[model samples]
Target: MEKKPSRSTEDRGISRARFLAGAAALGLAGAALPATGAQAAADTRTGRPGRGLTRRGVVYTVGAGETPGTAWDPARMRADIRAVRRDLHADTVDVTGDGVERLTATAAEAAERGLHVWLQPTLGDAPQREILEHLAECGRFAERLRRHGASVELSVGCEFWLFVPGIVPGETAQERIENLQTGTADPEQVQRRLTAFTARAAAVGRSVFDGRLSYAAAQDDEVDWTLFDVVGIDYYSYHQDPADYVRELRRYLRWGKPLAITEFGTCTYAGAPQAGGMGWSVVDYDKDPPEIKGGLVRSEHTQAAYLTDLLAVFESMGLYAAMAFEFLTADAPHLADDPLHDLDMASYAITKPVRDRPGDPASPWHWEPKEAFHALSRRYARAAC
Candidate 1:
């Protein structure tokens, strides 16, 4: 990865003390605080305490194969959850799944093991109708889980910003409408859809039982704020200075809702070339090799450093929740099976290699805890107690 000169060192005479003083004057707390009105409303909707919710919960990025009785044996899955709970001293685990049944069952299992569960389901490339149907399905699923006496703390559409019509990689508003046959769809359409979805969920809660539902969105866009009870942002370690990334988060706080760092991890693929002729050569940050045709690939040590710095900022922010990007991945074959995988893909596998050769296993990419992980775990354990 081409090293951008660290912002921590500007040629200007300003020192770290001055910067800290400025940040303190800004009234930015990296961790929890008294709930604002919007945050209280969101907490009511989500069935979580608005204040003191930042027990520094663990966000486990679960894959399809790692579920109970699947790629991981039931015993192993339970044991892993137990181990994570013990290690992090955390009681909450966020899980992603395909549908309501799978997610509800997973949540129930975790709840049985004394863990609060958050269900995350990706609203795939389905059109508007299908998407609404899926939301209704989620409502029904939440009802069923409640009937079964399972306590699912939250139900959020995973990567929801990816599915918003006008947004996303390709497809314009006109194209999205033609595809949906729905009326002219814009950001308003996206917001309306989300509002209706959440409204229906709240209605279902009133009719049946109450459950929390929100959407997890990438922190990239300003318009995403209008859609949810609680705001969710995926904070990554792609930036040079983690503090800069946290500063960007202040804009989202304007929404006045409780915020969650729903997905956070240091990318291990820094040396990969920029995609689609973006015109950046990928170089290994560790080696600083001349730009090969590929773009910059991040090193494992850089990844750990990024996480540590970012987590410190998060700790100072007093946000509602911050979850690590992932826990583990299937073996390399499984990783290869993911079509999204490419040279530049950001994989959080703490156990994978950038190249076939033996890379830095001690790097943040390895499964073992690094200094950053220990620091975060200690912080979380302290906060939880």
Candidate 2:
């Protein structure tokens, strides 16, 4: 992997000024920063509502097979995770699933190697009953892991906001179906469901390990700062400048909850002439660049640079933890394609042609580490200490 270029003197000068400005605003200017874990946690949670638990370091994730299959070779998965740990000096990995069996096994594997595990549950397109059942199942799994002396740092419902009603205006029944299919729903209803699910999860946590429990919100709007132990947001800057992205992040910081960049990435698709902005283009990755049948272009160095800048800002802001969107995949390029692109369904994907061609599993973007991944690993390695 290539090393991230060192910041120029001028860039460093600007960063120093920004840092000082932020410090002064936060009233930390000229104060001796807490050096120990207990003090650090206290500093972070003093005025905050929930228990103060600062993340040990940055966390990253990789998806297993789309559905359960031998496609998720345990040895290969372990090797990839081990390589990432060595490269980034990271100590945590996130594994997502419907229940705890797979997650428990994965966590056990990670623990043998001394890495912390963050478990994420995919709350499929089930109604309230199913969602609740899934949460209960996760609680049981969490208890099992705790019994084995493993700790779970976070529990996420991958994309709950995408299923809520009225979050985005759906003009027709097709649009409505598409919205629900993608899990986009009204923000208020999202809050209700989130509150209920989290409260239930909390009850489970009390029965299990004494560590923290948190949910990964799809976007800032989906985040109920008051309800969650940590404030989690996804940062994909392909559509917006890094500065503007950080500006949006400021809102969550005010809630005083430790923040996590739960998911962040750029799509391969470039902006469309008719597309309103970069944000819209990224959000609808399967739609722009009309000439490409699948809608996505190959990932670019520009995307990597954007990620580098975004991480720098997060570090400067003193964020609690951050995780990249994903690692390797059995579905490779188009794992996120179906619900993202299906135009007949509501067209969230920037690319068209939802599925990859038969036998050729390479995603439109493929799995080779882009400049962004390399840049991210280098930054994370340096930040780990």
Candidate 3:
């Protein structure tokens, strides 16, 4: 079957610095209730969890984590962490981006909030020197957080074959995906290259960051589990089958190391769980001013159920931690009747993005919490109880 060309993520001309400067004060304050088993996992005094490394987490991404030109809003980033901590009741947040400065700034913000930080600095197919440079800065971020008695972990990178150059014979992630599917890329060679670099990163990271360390691995990658403290996977459910999903998860148990889900979530569209991560491309771009191609209904309920079902698996399986794919997916503001163009439609964020409304004085972007937000909060509260 011929795969149709994908409708690329529409670039809404939001400048990075413009958004950064403009989006600083977008948070509504609220006190967070403690999370379940968080105290048991970290020290009560410093609020530094992860002596045992258990976590309830969400990936606080800026610009989908992979989109080029993604920048961070220091104030909004801090506020999002607070929202994740307070709103979601999640104890940890995986701050992901390819920008080293952005990642370090995020770690500082997370530290100030007394929240556990997973600094996942992405490597965007750069050279060895650049990769090492990013790793060194990440080490500094981790060390600084530790000095302040904050819990921090450095995920060297995620899914190297897709992100790093020279590991696979592709110029772009999409090309690599196609190469893998078409049997043009050698899987064994890719694994070897990825493993070699990962080992090097672990050594560099350990030299400075005397805290926990792991990588956000894709499940299919043949990695050496012995090198790290925790085994992380970007596991998403296509709802292939609940039984089969659990069976695949059980396969990780053979490694005997702790398991962490680094990413997972569905789009807000109806029947999204079945579509999985690709649920966002609801447009056929062959036509000028691409038209909405999906026939599915818009269903926040489907997204909520998808989240709960996966969390249920993690809870029953005694996995280390599961970070939802994200806290904020896109910075695009909502426009009425333009549902297809609304960036939040493709986002896994639990908050629906809205423009400035009357009576809300903090900022231009207003985030309306979704059902998953409340569900996660309640679940975390119950677990903590």
Candidate 4:
């Protein structure tokens, strides 16, 4: 897999200290609890107290079988989904992957566990027709789940500009990203293509799915939210004031639709929080077994703080849903004894999958929760009640 370019504050030409200072000047709270609680009392959108973040969830990925640690086993998928509800205290689960069957089955398992299902099919680097077909099939399954009393929503696609081919004249996601960065790809043309494709996706989803429709847009992707029921964005905050998120996200409110932070969370490393969405790029995948680039320090505390801080922001804004980027990256296992090989430091998962321990006699895989897991459990437990 190619390294995703970082969307850090520095990348956006904003100095961290300057942005922080500006945010403080704007009276944004630096603390997690107090300011958010106060903001929740009066939603900026309505000038009244709004229901803040009704759905708390995590992204659960079931990779295609091409990978070694794909969640292909039905029993294991069930157990993982059960943990999302029982252990994490999340009310929703965003099931994302490429395989139509795997995505449907895992979403069903989450629904069975009484978790709201956000069926997101990510068919990266595939033909447009194939991607639409995958989404159509998933949509059909989602409608069935909804008819069966499951709370389900179908996200037709995510980051389609990079994932879907011919959008920006690149063969791969990385190349397309680079092309956009270097000015080789025209932004207006990309938006035109993205707009057309998103309309088609929404039409296909509406054709087969009767439930609410959404799309997990890339942080910078321009989307026509009027086509969908929910305004969802994969928001990743760099070293900016929480108030910055409110100011920027407030624009989406113009559509008068509920907003969802579809993807947010940082890797477990000292500086990972500052890296934001591109934190995972720390891994050098060119090697046979990918290894963490040198000099990065592992810090579970940083990851925990990053998540709660963002949750506070979302709560203050009275967002509808906030799904952490992931539950676990099975392929990125933790090697406690080997710093260079500790891939978990690059994963956004709250659970740390053991390197040598795939599972015990009772299960096919095993993982231990990081500090973020406990922090999220406490917050979600309180919010759900």
Name the top TM-score candidate. Answer: 4
The C-alpha lDDT values of all candidates are 0.46, 0.46, 0.64, 0.75
Off by over 4 Å in 4: 1-51, 69-71, 357-365
- TM-score versus the correct structure, for each prediction: 0.58, 0.61, 0.79, 0.84
lDDT of 3 by residue, 1-385 (tens): 0133333332322122111111111110111223334333223223232223267788876443222322356667777778877778888888876677777777777777777888887756467669778888878878877877888888877766666677777665545555666679786887788888888877887776777788877656677878788888876545433444555676777988889988877777777676554554564446554444655456678788788767766665668888887676544334446765555565677887675652222345647788878877776766655
In the range 98-142, model 2's lDDT, one tens digit per residue, is 444555556667666666777666544345456555666665666
lDDT of 4 by residue, 229-326 (tens): 99888766654455555666666678999898888888899987766555766777566466788679999999998898778767767789999978
A best-first ranking of the candidates according to their TM-score comes to: 4, 3, 2, 1
Better of 1 and 2 by lDDT: 1
lDDT of 4 at 235: 67
Query: Model 1's lDDT to the true fold?
Result: 0.46
Better of 2 and 4 by lDDT: 4
Clashes of 3: 2
Error of 3 at 206 (Å): 2.2
Task: Note the clash tally of each candidate.
Answer: 28, 23, 2, 1
Indicate the residue-level lDDT of 17 in model 4: 19
**How far in Å is the alpha carbon of 17 misplaced in model 2?**
38
lDDT of 3: 0.64
Of 1 and 3, which scores higher on TM-score? 3
